[model samples]
Target chain A: MDSMLSTPRAPRIAEQAAQWLEVLQRGGAEERKAFAVWLTESRRHVEEFLFMTAVDRVLEDVDPQQRIDVEHLLTQGAGKVVPLPAERAAAVSAGVDRVEPAGMRRRSVMALTALAAGCAAVAVAAWGLLAGTGWEDYSTVAGEQRTVELEDGSLVYINTLSQLQVRFSETGRDLRLLQGEAMFSVERDPLRPFRVDTGSAVIQAVGTRFNVQRRSRQTTVSVLEGAVRISTEAQTQEEGELVAGPQQSVPDSGMLQAGEEASIVVNGRITRRPIAEVARVEAWRERRLMFRADTLQDIAESFNRYNRSPRIRIEGEQIAARRFTGVFDANDPESLVAFLGAYADLAVDESGDELVVRMK
Target chain B: MQTESSKQTDGLAGTALEKYRKDLHRFLVRRLQHAEDAADLAQEVYLRLLRVENSEWVRKPQAYLYGVAAHVVFEYRMRTEKEPVTFDSEVMEQLAENPAGVQPDELGDRLGLERQLERLLGTLPPTHLAVLLLHKRDGLSYEEVARKLQLSVHTVQKYIFQAKARIRMEWQRQEAQ
Candidate 1:
């Protein structure tokens, strides 16, 4: 039996559950009735519901005994969210210094595992790096761009509101995109297929260069050279179909040709289109964002990627559809918004780090 | 080594009874803040275990024993007044003055969060409370909890779920508040 069908491989359901749990936790009235209805619908729903409920329970029972060090737990986002003071004391009482070795071990293991994931498509021994460490993590706020070099010779240009974990293993290299977009310039090694894991899907290179971007719950893969195979778990080798095309929404098996762009949606739907200009697609490499005719919401979201400051606020559908185009330093999205505000017939106000924009 | 006939031996009784006695006693001592009372409840765990029919029928001895101990603690707390244990004074003194980057506007956020947690914790039933304490406070395994309660692992998990749902309701109330 295909694991996809057997498991009901619906991340949408999981996401829905998480959202409903959040809503219930946050006391959203609309979700309460919906959740109750869903819970009583089936025994399986109740079981699935209970798992997340356990997590919520763990979060609420924040132990004062564990309140020794707020910094470590809060920094790692590891423990349940508690008052800063309690967290700090817990950290101290638990002795954060004692957990350092264990934390390091976990981090190194995670780094190695990420590396192994990269080499999944290609054959490579996992022994070489003995210890994986010292890869700088770079994250851009809503609309920003920065270039970073990995331990391996490859260079990565990160796009707005994006994060990538760089791990170089003896086998090859791996990159996990926690949030945003990145363009990778690979140092070609056919023996070690460079791989990228975004939140939505995983892409393995066939000695090719490509750019992967993760937005919301969608992953966009654009191949610049050779070919890259993208797969969702739903269409993996274990499934009836070994090689899924652009039409298949499964996670483990989709192929993309050079100069082609493909996206895997949140609901496991895939769409592919031919790229008009590779340069436009990889504009972040030169610290530029060319939206052509993109929605204002997308433009604002792109700007939000650059920094926590200069928050973009759009009111209603009236101004959201307004298409934007121009060449601006992706590093400073606020300034771009300010520049656009000058003539776009949009009222813009900059207060501290927040930028509010409304149709004039 | 833990033969049925060896129950009367001082070494076996001391080692077997003392394992959870001190820990359970210590937990009770903290919650009740009365060493004598905690000590009494700890003794009750042994008494209850000894009274179980064909106690030798228990295969997982330690698990069964702890389950009995946890129930005693739960009953003891419920039967007594709720003098909720709080963070120590030294801990409280250190808690003053929020972290450096908390921002001036967020000074009262911690107080609000505490209020929220208090309301949420209040909604859970005593057994669910025991489950929370056993799982979160003591870090007991599901098997241990089930064995102690004379229930299956699924039931223990259900108790945890019930506790969580109640907390979730409290969190919802806090959000509205």
Candidate 2:
């Protein structure tokens, strides 16, 4: 049935509505006058516009189960004449479900990659289906750090060059640390346990403070507050077993106590170490990065988190092996490098906007 | 609302500087949605203005100050990798409940009308479309559009009027078809 909006004056009325919306978005006195003219152009124009807008308002307000006819709407473009198809009516409904699957389960690694490619990951994932599963996505570009507050009130502070995802439900909070490091301050939610999936294995925590670093196939978990249970798909049965020895069942799965670190290699080998100041490992929250006796290469890489510029290349093995420790604000890395050059007798050379560290 | 000249003079003596500073900061905070960051950048703007060698070049002081703030915001966005800063869907859903008392029937009709207008807009030639977008989308005045595109005001107005009439006719034809 042709509606009231299907009348001959429909287009003019629609134009009037578009004009008003435009004026509202870009407010100007003249635009306001034009909008007023559109409104008072004719009684029919006014009535039709009101009718169409009311339908839109209803589409927005009513049952979310209503489906949208995106294909029909795409064809109509922005015209106001034809009645909204079932798809158009349900467009908002479908959009709501689009976010659920990924948000519900593990956000696909491909989803994160698409996100890095400047595609709207959340929006696209909300609108369309993602390719891969079991991969969580987390990303912070150079000189950028992000903190994501989980549904359970736990905060995850991601350091630079990091991407990860946390999928939490009544079952548990599962995280896929795709790449980079994240310090998690988990809230005390005993019912829903927290687990981080680092491709190879999972780091599960129940009311714990810890940091997880994922580099390619290798994953590291450092505990600070409460104890964390690091397990693989194999060790799920041995709930009470403290598989401490090197050649235990799920090769790398082990328990890490407070101030302890654990690394899992690709071949399922796990190593644990003691860390004194866990704050140094999770310094991204305070906007300060700390490096303890790291190689010059590691230090430079670390500095890249704070300062994106200065491609520092240590000259010889001697200089590259030299260790240093200093505190720095996230924005400034120039003085830190300069200070090193002065003390170590190394030359700080600027070659095409890049700071090179070599023998003087 | 003081004169630009007075504001410029007051900026130097740090007299009205506090008030201007607060107003500009508030303006940016609302626009950017970051209070602390806005205040920091606002301080930078004032510092730059104070340090400017030719502050008197700004005839329209409020416009110039806004222009500077806009530029600063632009530069800040440029310096950082773009993050997805989206409106909260839940909040938006909540806001959609009443939508500031906009009549439902009227809003629906307007949406349909908007769609038709957009379709009509698509049918225009590139130049006509540019004129329409600049005039309507960008809200550029006839004179401003002419200045921006290096055309006369008459030419810009003609393009706009023609574009509007053409779109109106196209709508009529589509309705008939």
Leading candidate by TM-score: 2
Q: First chain of model 1: TM-score?
A: 0.54
Instruction: List model 2 lDDT by residue over A271-298, tens digit each.
Output: 8889767557766666776767777877
Write one digit per residue (lDDT tens) for candidate 1, span A1-360. Answer: 222222323334433444444444333334444555554344334333433433343343243222222233233432222223543455456565464432322222233344335433323333343335634467876555676655443667787677877656555466677787787766544334467766456676533468887877688888875566676652223312223232244444666776789998876677899977776776766667678888888887766655566567777797888887777766686676667668757777777777777777
- Once superposed on the true structure, which residue ranges of model 2 sit more than 4 Å away at CA? A1-136, A233-252, B1-177
TM-scores, chain A, per candidate? 0.54, 0.55
Q: Which stretches of candidate 1 lie over 4 Å from their true place?
A: A1-146, A170-172, A234-252, A331-345, B1-177
Residue A84 error, candidate 2, Å: 62
Using Cα atoms, each model's DockQ against the true complex is 0.03, 0.02
Cα deviation at B83, candidate 2, in Å, is 36
TM-scores for every predicted model:
0.38, 0.40
Candidate 1 chain A lowest-lDDT run of ten:
A238-247
True contacts kept of each: 0.02, 0.01
